[model samples]
Target chain A: MAASDAEAPGMRPWILMSPALGAVVLLLAIPICFILVYSFWLRSAVGSEQVGFHLDNWVEVLTDRFYRDILLQTLRIAAISALLCILLGYVPAYFIARSTTRHKTVLILLLMLPFWISYIIRTMSWINILGVSGALNVFLLWTGAISEPLQILYNEGTVILGLVHFLLPFMILNIYVSLDGIDPNLVDAARSLGATGWQAFLQITLPLSLPGLAAGSLLCFVLGAGTYITPMVLGGPRDAMFANLVFEAIITQLDWPLGSALSLALLVILGSVVMLYTRFAGIGQLAKSFR
Target chain B: MDETTRYQRLLERFRNGDLERRTFLTLLGAASLGAGLTGGPLKGLQRQALAATPESVRFDGWGGVVSEAFRKYAFDPYTKNTGITVIDGTFASGDEYLNRVKAGQEGEYNIFHASGVFDYARYVNLGYDVVLNEDNIPNLQYVMTALMEPFRGVTGGKLSAAPYDYGTTGLAYNTEKISKEEMEQKGARILIDPEYKGKIGGSGDWRTRIWYGALATDQDPNDIKDMDAVWDAIRAHRDLALKYWGSGAELMSLLAEGEIYVTEGWSGRIAALQQQGHPIGYYDAPNGYAWQECLMVLKGSPLEACEELLNFMLEPDVAIAVAEGQNYPPSLDPTKVDLGEKIPELPAFDPTGKLAGLTFASPAYWNGNEAEWSKTFGRVQKGY
Candidate 1:
């Protein structure tokens, strides 16, 4: 009876998990399998897909200098954007975590307000702020700061700026979670031992927050690398990311095989990043940020 | 054989006393069970047994004033008359829209406001087209033969789309910055001019880029022998361009804000800007890019409902109203229909109805090279 009871518990967990396992298999794994199969097919001259096993798409993706350069550029942009997010995000997060204010929930709620607006709208809002006749230029011209409006909207810098805007809250929230988890007594203990406030923070608080910072960086890098819209909306002709190439392949060129290959390439790279992060930072810290 | 023929054969066999009563009954029951389980004709029967009328039909189009006009003049009135809902959707570009339609199920996308004969040919080749009964859409007679003929030629004399409007991708310049004489003199070459560097914008569309490139190189767009020179011209334009605007709204915004001094612009969008009192001057260069828009009924659509909607949209009052509202000239031949005053004043207005003056891309030529040129253009546009 005891052996049967033990087996029942094991089977109960599996039964309980079956729906989620089924969902993952049906929604995620199956679609990826389809994409993998499509990557081997050939696109006909007439734009319809030719069903066959072919290595042409994979060969081009792996060997082409164009794809390599675009992929490298995407990684570079994503790294810069993530680093910028860290530098800009840590201060507000520290303040919020160490705050003695009563309306802390309100502050956090305000931080989440940007999520209420569409991401595309938020990306596009930069055009109104940074365009030649936009608010910044208008304000600058009104103050006689410059004789002419600065042409500032469509460029690589603006694309990064848009990414940072979209990703800042995520960084702040993750870092804040890390900061909040550190015991206040640790800083007090350091301070009591003749350490300055700065020394206490550097020695105690910053070290504890490293995991959340890494998690936020991972999230930001993966998202920034995968973005197509920001560059399409606020970027110059030369500021396209890796995702835009996939878009051009599938939509403009009607080459689904090439697009599928390119997309899988991106997925593998980003997935490797996540796996590496998991190896060091115990992926559980990523979930703590949401809570 | 069909279910009816099989049933009749079974009945005849039984009446001829070729089978016992119990054996006949067993065979009939087995046939019924097989038909129920295996479907085939039963699926058709099930569909026929369902609703005779569809609840709603979907129509996708370019947004902004175009959608507004259709809503106010065409779809809204059609819905009011027929007691059916029109689900209006918007697409940023034809390529993006085609990708979406390809990914979706048949009948999910009932109609599309498609651009150009090449796009029609692409759809036909992709097998997304549906034949419309001409007798139902009686108002198709008023459309210009010039506009209709190209689409017909693409589909081998059967149209999957009704030509609705026509426009040109002409050079739009900031009038305050560039003189009309300079624009006319420079023509397509102005986009590649060194002085206009960092002050020019162009459509991000591959076809528009290639079309302008061909013109800049003094080659016919329909038949380009030296593609290297055209590519060089495109490279020059790319280096000089400030931005590649994606939508009509962005094109107007760029010209209106003076961010770009010169770029290829849509005739109707430029007209809209001019009407808004922006200092934008539109001049179609010699051998300029001209194209027509069509309302295409996709396969698996409820044919009668979509036909009714097309007929309503093609009416003189609705077409003229939409034309004036969106600033594109209607497909109605001015020689046949009195298209009122505003359409006559619109950009790319074809009073002659022959459209002999405007040059259009040959579907065979463009669609034939779509797989290669479109992919190559993607690389070239990004500093290749």
Candidate 2:
């Protein structure tokens, strides 16, 4: 019976893992390999794909100063967006975590409210609010807040605002779950030992919630980096993101090989950042915090 | 023994004497009968199957009142008449829709409403369009000669598209912002007038901006194809430019907001805005504007059905309805429609008319030098 029990545990884990392993290999690994292979192909003169191994695409990306500048700009915008999400999300998440059961449920629902609507609708709603002749401007003009309409619709500031509005719920939910998982007894114990409220929070609660913060930051950063629609709708031509460039390369120019190379470059950058976060911060703990 | 042997001998004689030929004849007769029975039923099944499957036509082009009118008149009528469905895939810009076709989703759409400038030789080379049969369309004879001649394919033996509607890209402005006296005094040269600096809204289209710059300086647009002249003119008038709008909708919006006193826009869209109570007015400049827009059928369609639809679209009443509905001038003769107050007076395409000399957008100019031109424009326009 004891020997059978040991075998059962081993068999159970393998049984549970098979579907997940199969899904990852089929959906993720295979497509990624295809993209990697295509990245080495060449683009034809007329912007069509030529099926041959060449380093020209990679070299172009590496040598072109415009591409490099855009890449750096994308990274900077993504980082700023992620940092903003963290700042805006923390207070609400903390409040929700410390709230009573009913309040906590309401707060969680409020965080998820925007997700009920389509992402496109939510993004476009900003246009209605911020356009020169739109609702907000009309109201402001009626109240005599300003003489002329404010130029707020198409710019970097509005793009970041849209990103934050889209991504804040994920950050808050992740952080809230992490805070909820912390034992109340530990906090009481810390306070009972004469530690001040700030000290208790700094040494205990903050450290405990680090996993959630890391997870939320990773989610926000990757999403912001890969965002296309928000930036396209709200941003000017100069504010084109890396994803938009990839889209234009493949769809507009019909240069699939170059698009593959650019996509892989983005994936590698995002992967390295994730790996770095996992090294110092525990990815498993971060994932668990979301639950 | 004697009786059994006699019976067997008689049967063997019957089997050996051309019996195989007789049996083959009988089988052939039966096969023919079976085919005769099933042929009509098979055709019925095919018709039913086609009926069960929804026949859908997709219209891809710029979105606004024009697209809305197409949805109402062309798409809806086509669907109602043929029991087919219509899909309205409205694009914000022509370049974006062209990109979609380039991405090899051309076959997915049944029809494309493209501007002549946007759909070029590359599309033809890629086999993205179908040749239209003039015989199938009785109304083909009524299309304006100039509008019909250009799309008559490489051999001039076939047409790749039918003339839907034609309009010139011209100037749209707020009459409230820019006085009529000033416009009359300045004429086409108002764009370059140094006194009215920082009060103009130009389109983001490279061709329109370049041509406007050339015409403003009293230079022939066709001769000013060089990037140097284009950039120089833009820089000289940079102080006068308020913004560069990417679409007619954006131009109208800017005009409504009073941010732009005068700007480049389509006459139809400006007319639509005026009808909707916006303070926008349009003018055909003396140096002339660009004529654009065409209706092309997708390749690999049911040719007979598409031909029928094309013919239906070109009917005099249909043409008038489409023109009146979309705010574009009908390509058919003016006598076809009763000139009510609802229809705005549009300039005639006659050579002697005030808006006689018009240039169409050419793909060659942008396709070859977009990067350089965009860079120059970016520098001079200061990134609008």
Candidate 3:
């Protein structure tokens, strides 16, 4: 082949890149641009939209103590859920990684089984099991474990349970991939030394696994923060999340500008958190953790 | 030669009379068929030839036995007569429907059935809707005069909506669990009553408990113009409420499961639950419940088509069908309806010309203040 032929093959790069680039520009960039434009607009007094542009919506959202408090609450809930997922997911993922090939596949599939059903259905199922007259209470009463049914469904506990149930699989899957990639000989080498089991594992395995744990925690936190259905179905009225407020803004109040501002605020916060994670824990390591 | 000419002349004469008789017969037939054929098609063609023709009549409203009944009896008949299709869209809440309208997707629907409480002057101000054509609705005259009076244009002769269904917001109790007498004895103050504490389940809307608070306190519910009072009332009963159900279906399920013994709800919903084999009962307190649900046409609908549908829905038989089907009392002459004994007489709109008014909550109250209200209620309820 001539030099021109090699250069012609380079043109194939653009050809391959065009479809994804076009899709991103059309689907993501354009909508985000529209939302950016709307976030600065004013809401009509009579309804939810106005014909004029202003910084009122942003100022209101930024300065309002109510929105600030909810934002904090949302972050707190998400952080807690992420921490819980990490603590709960690590052991199972490590076990799965150390298992035989067939056992590993079965264990991974078991972790993934819940995702096959809808998240909403899974969340609502808790109601059937935990509600005032639901199965758990009925069973407890029948067994003489309690005189009256317990009020367990519509509370923060149920919300957390639902979040953990929906998100733990993703965490486990990420951590499992990271652990699977580790050389078993490294553990043997550590064991060959005077290092104890706990010491070797902590010094070698845990630090190396931090990238995967961070990546898993990030996924859980972003999802937990953005989740509306689980909270709406499982949480009580007082447990309304920031996303639910955004939903009410867009769907109930028809305030698109404010809704857009709220959504963008959430995105910015999540993006910042991800950026921070990327800085502290290399993004490349995070990527390999999912490999 | 003379004999031949005479024979030819007679033959010509016979041919002319036969042709004349055939022409006369055709003319007589066409004249007799005139009213049925010419008037019908000609009028239709004239309507079709109009400058602006609606593609269809989009009906955005709640879905249930009532809406279904309205579609079957009223909406279908109108479409059949006028060649317009009724597009049915169901909403889980008034807020949801209003959101669609506010999004400027009002073009997707031509007619919307909304609570009169939710439809304020703002809708008119926003150019989302227009006044109903009185000329097309002759049955508007037959609508119970009380229901008609409230919907008339505020300024003068212009009217924004046509009244269709009227029912009071009252206490709905599972009759199997709680008796009618017991509910009535608790009266409008049932939610706050120590006996019913934690047993009451309220619809998520703030209007239900707010009005009940007004009634229980002997203040006229209609006169509750202050927002503070409404908030206070809601906060007071927040502890007593089991949950704020977002839909009638959810409430019905709760009632069926005996999770809720009593709660404030629309009479139509109670009636619907009763039909579904749930032993639900409704009581009309002395303070009276809110009356709502009116049909309004979007601003740009073909006036003639909208008027026709509006008129058809207002017809006495159609009203009765909607009421009986939806479990709501019809806003028409009760004597004209064969409702049997299912409808209670005391809760019925006073047909005797005596004016009994009910309090209503406008969407304006919650439009801007929902965030604040939600925060306030959340804070107070959480005891923060």
Candidate 4:
């Protein structure tokens, strides 16, 4: 091939990718750099910030037992929510993938409907469902199942529940795409060879869909861990996550420097998880599910 | 050299044919653009045009009924009288709003209805506080001297804000669960009462929590000799609390829905609950949190327009209507301005106008300990 011909193919991809790369650099990378710079500054007694190269915020964020506890709690909540999403989402995903109905598009459309409403509104809707005078208690009262309303809302459980609610669609869609891509002949062959339906699913279908499941798990876990709103709205005082600590530091304490450090700390930890997932499962699988 | 002399020299070079026509034109264009961008006559002209008539001024407040009152009485009428639109915004707390203001560009936040003298002091300390031309705001005379004194104390005897309203973070209890007599007797101690475990509620704000914690420990909130006792008291409240409600709406909802039997709630919010016929009672326990809210004009606001709006808002009719609407007493000294019948009936109304009964937060003491205490409270709140 000519030198120009060889260069054209390589340059074409770069030219095509430039806009997206520029956007990511502008929106994500630049802000992160600013946060990294801000993490070293100091917040004074009167809430005024002193801009300098100081390690107080970093030292505190690294050494503080309080931040460590909240980080662990955040990870625990995110993992629980991701597991719940997988458990609840997989059945729907499989059913949708295998559906012979003409209204399969409608099912996918219905799944996307929740995204139209504001996330804050959706998180807050739990209040109407689980509040003392809410629908659940009233229904329970009418059914004569209990003497009083169950104090079910505003706990770690509700925070996880809210996370699952917000994240289930992503999980379902990812798994559904994976299941849809699976060859019917593979499952049919497994069954034809005297394998039972469950065995066929376990061996042929489930193993093939692992990439999508991993992708969904990563997305759900990252989103859940990074959420401050779910805990602020649905969780009790003790149920605050790592994001809530960043929020309190920045907003309540007016300690932007500390908030920056805390946020970076969270990003680094979550980034390690992403790196591990990429190393094992391959990052291309995540892209494949979207495609 | 000065920009003017440089511009003249460039013009002379251009006219004398020492510079090519294209180069002269390019240089002239660049110089004009630079002057425009870097604050020359063009920028001054833009400022003059904007000041001639500001199209809109933003006014952020605590939202819910408070915002409704401002929208109905103050902002809507102000817009009607003058064409300047009042852009109504809301914040969950002063801290949240302050952080937003810090992140935002100048003039993005115009005026805020801020609570407490500490908030005013913080703004002053951050240099966001604007020295209002009080002579333009004729209605300043009607505001209580006591309310204005604290703000003046913060800003060195010049007001950055007009005293808007006053209320307390008083003990609000469910009348069905706890009697008025019990609330009055138990006072701040009702929060940490073991009998009300899992049934109690409290504000999530560190200041309010710490203030009540001080009262529960029987230590003066303004001067705490033992910090550990306050933290312990707060920890006890945290253990017992059903949820530390974040906003006025949440506080009202918790009480109205019977989620919590007792909480330290905003005086206005609790009054709103009472008016909604929720059987909620309010009591100003000894040294209950008495805070004054202000119409603080921020540094980069349209000064003359903001001053005029401040004056209009403080008008007795407007102030009284807002007071009745929000269920908070207007800062219009009841003695100076004949505040309507309902004004006196509001939760924290001080008819005497002296405000000697209400105990306000000392700005110096609170702001001094703000960084340390707010962080500590954040830890203690999350089960430290």
Candidate 5:
């Protein structure tokens, strides 16, 4: 590769990279530009897209109480789900990362086993597990915990639970990567300085693992905020998220202008969270979040 | 290797004007023909090539178990009656049909099934829906005139879409949970009754929720222009409706589980559920929501062939087969057909006189308030 690079310094690099550049321009940049342009367009009465420029969609999105409330609710739910993911995901990741090579590999493999099945199937399974007349209630009744079936699903509690379940693996893997990168000698040195076990973890381990935590939080928050299925399947009418609004506008009403506007708003709002995270945590940490 | 060498030598000699042209052409044709008849999608194309020039018209409609009935009752029978082949494609709504046509595919499909007034009006307004005449479709006379009036497809009050099977969004309850007295005392207002809290699964697919919510608050679904009051009732009723079903399958699952006691339900699905041995009861509210699916021929489509197909579907035996397969009531006279013995909910639906009570959603009203109503409903859905 080094010899080839030296041999073909004349326009070969640009030629080699052109396909990937074209793909990015075609797939990502163009569609995003389209969404931006369409957000300002209009829907005709005949269900056709009309090309024009208008601020009405933006105005309506900002002024309307319905969009405002749903957006706010989506943010709240996303934040809670992400926090829960961090709280729950940290323990397993710490243990797994601290494990020997063989055990850590097996644990990581076990964590990814459910990915073979679909997201929809996983979410629907929760319904059977948490439905009033479903497995959990049956188990509780059998154990004589209560005579009546508890309303476990179609509520806020179940929605958050489902989201956490969905997002836990991502959080764990991210944190595990960061934890694995931390030199064991650092924690040992902290302990040798007469620091307690908790002190060693708090000083050497916790500070080092912040990058993974931030990355996982970003993934979980963005996904949970935009999730339509978790709410649609597990939660009730009062559980619809912001994605549901965008979907209804585009699919149900065929109102592209409005749908695009809502999508842009969602992206911008969610994007700001990441920017803020990067600022507070440092851009280098956020960049390493994905891997 | 020796045989191949000899054959190459012979072929080389032939190329040098030693072998006959007839022998070469025959060998080549035989080898290609044998392989062509062997396997794959090409075999199907080969069979088509061998058959009579197939007279066919492409159709776009909804898919599911019902599309199977379309094949058994309509497509096969229509093909038998007239030699036209009916190819099928699936689409979600009239929205897709219009979009596909506008994208330079106007001639792709001849017949389409459009539902809801909003869907039908788009085709009509875009000059895509063809005007119908009773001469070609003599069975039009038998269809209930009440179902014939198009939402907005008219030239001085004449309908466009040939009325097909229709469904109503009324309350479906488990008889084991609800009592007859409740039905009589409250009617559709039961949707908002505190007694049924966390027991109702209101369908949250469309603006239909607002219509039902209006009924719960003693407002007429037909004249529900009052968004303020409708939104209020809808939000209020959301407390009672603990589950807002997104699909017919989801609603059916809830009903089967007995997780819900009552909810806004589809007519066909209720009948189908009953047939499936579910002990569910469908009560058609005299002042509740309803929408009918209709047939339309796109302009510049295979009009005559699609017309023949439509007429073939109207025949009693064929129409009955198709409608029964769908578990839906036909648009024809209900008293004439033995529907009560079949669906059990037919007599109550009262397809003939029931038109007065069933409020077909006004397309203009919905299209105008779509964004506002959709956003409101979105909030209600995720109110937590």
Candidate 6:
């Protein structure tokens, strides 16, 4: 239609997309805006929340040393998990991208199989394998590998492992999509010019696949940062994350205003990470990864 | 169609002139009233309608088997006796259910197992609680004295809730791992017990953790407002704990799998685990953590039917059935309940006459300073 009528208003095309756009605004924007408003409301002494504007909740979130630590810890965990996902996911993704089309379908299916089950069930399975009397311990004892059971579950390390385990597939799929788009001859050209395998990959395939790497790492980072269950179930006391604090404020403590403030603070932190990444990698580049 | 309904007989008698028009009208008005104002002739009709009326009462309860047990013991039988079918809904937390009711979204559920006794205070403060009609709940006479009393005494003061089930929270151990005698000596202080290093477990409920620290330190749990003292105590005992758990199921899994030798838990959950064939045993510590779980009807709810439901739960047989189903100590009068076999340790565990002995955490006391509590406790749990 636009090709036929060059003078047509851009609004006509947007009208066609309005239904999807309306849903995004309704489900995402309206709720986030509401949370932004509630962030200023006050929580009363008796655990009842009222609609009054105040900065106390914000001050508590931003100023308090504890909230600061939790926020920083959340960022730290997400960054590490995303970095690990990139490292772990890149190999399988590259191999899958290099496979025959018939094999690629089976490989991708196998990669996505674990996700068919619930996320919580997958996390609990880790508990069964990692806990003191869990499968790992029983196996180790049966093999006479150690005199005592190892306390592997409920620690910072286990929390990271859980996050990476949940997120590895997403990272793999994203990287594979970008890697699969590359022309196979580009790397062969470098190899014919006497470039080593590592050098050819570093110069050609890696640069081309940067879009997928950025997209997958960003996805992993966002999910890892926002996760509530993995750490809560597998990690010890110190493993409590920003989501848990938000959970307590709204659900347990009945302090919606404070919870809303905490939620917005988390969104700001996560949003800024995306924005900063976009500044360097460009949003257009990352969006093209999905294509 | 075989014998027609009571209304049919009334109509036949009226048409035959055996019944006066005034009498017929009065009878008709009373019959239509049903169980609305639950006293007098209307109630007798309700007893007749108990098997087939379309009227149904809904209960929002904690989910999983606990909700099923509530249906089997209290709800299902009540429906069978009275035609009012019981509709069941499940909730995860008290604040969640209260918020739903407060928002006017849950018009369907009148009677709710809203958290513990502490939450009852919040309900009253929030004006969500209805003044219970003790006349309708005659069997409240059999309710435990401590729960029935004025504001939860032996009796007489603005009763708003029917205390159903309560359990003790304190140090428990795998009997195969340690004797009760050894556990008692450690008591709540067992959190810091060196012998159980990396073997202790508890959920991350600040109130119970505070009570644990208070009991261990010989301080009144309810009296303390700030968790500074609570956390300091827990920090000292931090080494004994594995990690602060987030859910009962998580802690139970730890216990059931023998991941931990000593467990910090609630008696309700311990009972659940024991039924699953775990050798779980609670230490009868002198100072313990206890909360009375009550069923509260929301204000402006159908009071007549709600009160009757509460009263039915108080009956000796019904109370025992509930007690057996949940494996929690009956909140009704202990004398009325037969605790012969289902849960022998319940009576010994719950302090019917000596509620004062246990550290009762007040809702008012618990709500204050949660942010600070979590902040301090978070650091403490990390051994900071």
**Residue-level lDDT tens digits of model 1 in B1-384:** 865566567667878998787887676666545655876554332222111335788999988777888899889999899988999999988988999988865566888999998999999999888788888999999988889989888777888899999999999999999999999999999999999889999999999999999999999999998999999999999888889998888898888988999999999999989899999999998899999999999876888888989999999988998888888999999999998878899888878999999999999999999888988899999999
- Model 6, position B228, has a per-residue lDDT of 62
The pairs that clash in candidate 5 are A237-B381, A238-B381, A238-B382, A238-B383, A239-B381, A239-B382, A240-B381, A240-B382
Error of 4 at B22 (Å): 25
Cα deviation in Å at residue B32, candidate 3? Answer: 45
Q: In model 4, what is the error at residue A207, expressed in angstroms?
A: 0.8
Which of 3 and 6 is the better model by DockQ?
A: 6
What is the C-alpha lDDT profile of model 4 across A1-291, one tens digit per residue? 699998998899889999999999999999999999999998877787888999998888889888888899999999999999999999999999999999999999999999999999999999999999899998999899999999988888999999999999999999999889988999999999999999999999999888889999999999999999999889887999999989988988899999999999999999999999898888987776665
Q: Give me the overall lDDT of model 3.
A: 0.71
Writing each residue's lDDT as its tens digit, candidate 2 over A146-229 gives: 888776766688889989989999899889989999998899999999999999999999999988988999999999999888
Model 6 residue pairs with clashes: B50-B82, B50-B83, B51-B83, B144-B332, B144-B333, B149-B153, B149-B154, B149-B155
Q: Write the per-residue lDDT of candidate 6 for residues B160-190, one digit (tens) a residue.
A: 7887776777666899988877787777777
Query: Model 4, B166-268: lDDT tens per residue?
Result: 9999998988889988887788999999999989999999999999999999989999999999999999999999899988788988999888899999998
Name model 5 segments beyond 4 Å from true: A1-15, A101-106, A183-199, A288-291, B1-62, B76-110, B132-142, B151-160, B217-219, B224-228, B299-301, B308-318, B333-384
Indicate which candidate wins on lDDT: 1
In terms of DockQ, the best-performing candidate is 1
Model 3, span A2-52: residue lDDT tens? 998989888998889999999999999999999989898866665556756
Model 6 agreement with the true structure over A96-150: per-residue lDDT tens digits: 9998777768999999998899998998898779877789998999999998888
lDDT of 5 at A82: 96
Superposed model 1: Cα runs more than 4 Å off: A1-4, A282-291, B1-52
DockQ in order:
0.84, 0.31, 0.24, 0.83, 0.29, 0.36
Classify candidate 4 by CAPRI docking class.
high
- When summed lDDT is taken over every stretch of 10 residues in candidate 5 chain A, the lowest stretch is A282-291
Model 4: residues with Cα > 4 Å off, grouped in runs: A1-8, B1-53, B76-82
Chain B in candidate 2 has what TM-score? 0.74
Q: Candidate 2 regions off by >4 Å? A: A1-47, A134-145, A251-254, B1-92, B102-107, B117-120, B153-157, B180-225, B229-248, B259-262, B286-289, B335-341, B344-356, B363-384
